[model samples]
Target: MDASSATAGRTGRATDAASRRRPLIDLADRRALLACRPDDAEVTEAGRRLKEAALLDFGIKESVVAAWLYAKCHYQIPTTAVETAAVVAGGDGTCLLLYNPGFFTEIGLGGVRFVLFHEARHLIHRHLYAEPELRADPVFTLAAEVAINHVATQRLGQGLPTREVPDGRGGVTTERVGIDPREIHRSYRADLREQGLEPLGYDDFVLTDLTIYGELRRMRNPPVPPPQLCVHLAPDGEGPALDDETVGRVVEDALTETMRAALRSGGLARDEMLGLADRSESGGERLGRMWGRLGLAALRGETQKTRRVEWWKRWLSDTLASKLREGERLVYPKKQGAVLLALGHEPMLSRRGPERTKVVVVALDTSGSMPDRVVDWLTTLVGRTDGVESHWLSFDGAVMPFVPGERVAGGGGTNFGHVVDYVEGRLEVDGKRFEETADAVIMVTDGYAPAVTPQRPDRWIWLITDGGDDWPERHDPPMACHRVTTGDS
Candidate 1:
């Protein structure tokens, strides 16, 4: 039997291991088939070629990020399900790359690489900018396509994909190129001119995806239409269900693996990975947190001045709030008091009761490891929180009460057990006991000391410095632990 027929016969049926190992069919004819429903033979041929192109073309040096992303995706299914291609969250908590075989064949190898890279980018972009409001804007949708295509063209060195179309005469002509950011900018300029409004220059127009969307919004009438070919962007597009949670998990895992590989290789791939992290820093909270975990600032050679409100700070603040708000209740004035207040006699007040003051213990390991900047930031956050009593302790082998900006001399072995004893009211500092139970205990350390479980483990949050052992995470019952980028590492 022919290769195509043999492959077709096994399509809707399960196959043994031996059958699966057979070689894929090679297309005898490479011409684009125009039939609405191509024969099984043609479909099988197209699928085989498409698979070959992705495995061979995308795995080259030129396409580092794309190659890594494609490798991370567990499944690549070929069918007539999608018009071109799409990356969607699969039911089994993985990402699936769905493509139409005919569409892949029509665009050829260069186009296949372009489309694959484009789809991979779409997955990353979706994971980074997951804000619902951002996705809802039509301008933002167009801006994403422009930004993605722009980067793809630059990296792939393939300007754009062109498809062959039937001319009025018998011969075929090449037409229908991919989305061009420059062309869209020109349209915006023309629209602005017609409306007697000033348009941004090409450089400003294509700075970033958000910048593009913001500039497009200023136009009286947006010149560029929404992307029609993007299946994920279309509200009614058909395919497997795209789960946000699954997408986030898969993308995060893929990026983590890619970043590790780049770090080990340390070449063009590493540089490209760093660039990706820098560009995505402004995307959203999830992306920012992931980058922080990956030590983006350290890789980029950034210093203290370049640091902004990092993800760890936000996470710490939120965690403190949650811990402090526990068991708190709102107290309202009685009905009679409410009536009198309504009549302008007095104003009724509703306040959080049982709120003497929330106690927070912030212990910094001053064994010459903790960053001063982190200590300063933590002080500001804890000091500014209302109705909270703060205690600052600097500990190496022993604990000492010290205010922010007060330098405590240190050079000794680290002992987390001492800090725990003080916070749990077992040990005294300066001949005074910690009378109140701490609502939250934040420990900033290099994680060099032995792991010790606190009395109130739920209230403890550990911030381990870069290259430090995060032993708290592997304790009997893991505590909330996060790595803080020190920039030096």
Candidate 2:
């Protein structure tokens, strides 16, 4: 969360509306550590207060949230002085809170809770498991830090962490611990103005995980992060400090509880959490995902301005929504045997109830001609549809299972045979059935490739794009071939 800035470039989508978020911030070191020791009473008191603060403030009184520093970590060894607080991983992949109790004690209750909550968000955000490419960029790290700290500051309602420090001449004065997002943005603007370049506002500056990095790159001599803060962000980056899956699950569960508590109290935190569901693409997507899992209702409570619409989006939404709705059916109200017994005076059959769930595979012909709109539509459609378990695949010349949140790199080629080969059980790769002869297979393509036969022709849905071949429509055994008119209407 709290990482220093070194200029570099990276970015993601600027949703038509708002932005995404991250967490952490640093504070300047206070001379209070001179009295801090493993046996110091202040250390004991500080730890006790941290636990009380979380419980009284946000009800986050579990695990590291309530544990004292020593309870969860080792103090500085002779070789290392952990400046502030950090989450480190053990060999077995578990997160431990490592903090210089002296530093935490000095920050006081407000500051300590701020840092504690910030570190907690980092786990939930999965910064420790960031992609290698994202971790390699110093700018992205800084941006994440900025976005997180900004949210922390706003949510905590504390201006910033300022420590009373000892001046060299036996004088004391206030010094800020970590860099403030606004302070840094101001610095960038000053430099930009000298170069005749316009500067972005603070909101736009920390728009996404990577936005900060790109904007900072524009600055001549962008600020470097202070070493005294955000100690976890050294070269190794926020390394895997825990079993990512288990820790992530626990963190999300805790967050859900926190959100519920905040919502029950009816405050700014609740509104902010709800607003996230309607803002940036990433935030909205995350909210929608969590909503489906948690069954949290976030339906539109008000109307909004209109924006450019994608035709395929509406089509896919309606189609998938309809697929999930069950139709009326007849059933024997009594037990089957009882119904049979009653009718058996006449020897008749019993009735049944209906339940439906289907297996669906979505394949994409990701040749050079593949469109982004097409991919987005399908991803949203299948990924969010109820009652359907979906598998994604992108094929050009070879078959490959598509991983969500990853870009599908396509070569200049097309091969429907690979898809059909796997779906029909005619092909097996890596000793595994690439597919299980799914109940339905939807393939989206420009349809310029050769036609291939499917084991279940009746279940294949071919969506051909404009200005592309439609050979499936006239094939010997035609499937449902529809024209996917992907236009911005």
Give TM per candidate.
0.54, 0.46
- Could you list the CA RMSD of all candidates, in the order they appear? 13.1, 22.8
Error of 2 at 482 (Å): 43
Model 2 bad stretches (over 4 Å) = 1-37, 60-81, 89-93, 127-129, 207-210, 237-243, 258-269, 275-280, 283-489
Query: lDDT per residue, candidate 2, 1-489, as tens digits?
Result: 232211110111111101222122211112222232334454545555653565356432322322322233332221012445555544443345545444554556676667665666465445323465755566665666666677667666775665454455877566566658898889989999999999988888776544676788888887777543575456663332444554555555554443433333335434554433322225445444564333234122222232232323333333333333234211222354345435532111111225444567888877745567667656655655444567888888877777666788887678899888887777775676854547567888888888888767766777777666767868979765655655543
> What are the per-residue Cα lDDT tens digits for candidate 1 across 98-160?
555656666667877877788777777777888878876777777887888877777778777
In candidate 1 the C-alpha lDDT for residue 206 amounts to 71
Clashes of each: 0, 8
TM-score, cand. 1 vs. native? 0.54
**Could you tell me the TM-score of candidate 2?**
0.46
lDDT of each model, Cα atoms only? 0.65, 0.54
